[model samples]
Target: MYFCLFPTWHSKVFRNDVIFIYDKYFFNLWFDLYLKYFFLTSELIILISSLWV
Candidate 1:
């Protein structure tokens, strides 16, 4: 389900740009997702640790 959203999202972003630049930016979306997930997970871990303490 998550993967499906990515293609559509990238296509939308690509619509406004040239092919080469658009492909690069579209690929960066995955990196963005990784950073977002990493940040959220780290925050969750910190919150849980504080509660435990």
Candidate 2:
């Protein structure tokens, strides 16, 4: 048999928890992507600038 400790509030609590977890994961993923692109762009600019000088 299955049992729910908080039958009435369990669904809402579970949904909120899932959303919170997903938001954290997504935030980290996007932040890493942004940093990766920023570094790449900076490297390209430095290389181009050096070529001119």
Candidate 3:
């Protein structure tokens, strides 16, 4: 999902910034959480749509 990926890309682009460096671990953790959430949501949607049909 664009929402999930955008923040990671933004953080990578700003990696040299002082604030970004300080929160690098947080970003990594967030990125993982977003990826998991995205996949889970997508799968749930598919499951629900299949059941609907």
Candidate 4:
């Protein structure tokens, strides 16, 4: 899902010259959100497995 979204996101960033000014900031924000979502999902899975066990 991330891989699929990345191409379009990357293209949008590259296509808009003005956004290039804040590209690093935007990329960092995107990465942080992704990581948060990934970790939350992982923790939920672990918790569920523990409950099952």
Q: Best TM-score goes to which candidate?
A: 2
> Model 3: residues >4 Å from true position, as ranges?
1-22
**Of 1 and 4, which scores higher on lDDT?**
4
Candidate achieving higher lDDT, 2 or 4: 4
Residue-wise lDDT of candidate 3 within 1-53, one digit each (tens)? 65344545655666667656546666678878889999999999999999999
Model 3 gets an lDDT of: 0.72
What TM-score would every model get versus the actual structure? 0.56, 0.69, 0.58, 0.62
Which has the better lDDT: candidate 3, or candidate 4? 3
CA lDDT scores, all candidates in order: 0.71, 0.66, 0.72, 0.71
TM-score of 3: 0.58
lDDT (C-alpha) at residue 31 in model 3: 79
Considering only N, C-alpha and C atoms within 3 Å, which residue pairs clash in candidate 1?
none
Model 4, residue pairs in steric clash:
none
Where does candidate 1 have its weakest 10-residue lDDT segment? 2-11
Regions of candidate 2 where Cα sits further than 4 Å from its true position: 1-15
Best by lDDT: 3
Candidate 2 lDDT over 32-53, as tens digits, reads: 8889999999999999999999
lDDT of 4 by residue, 1-53 (tens): 66344534654657876655456566677788999999999999999999999
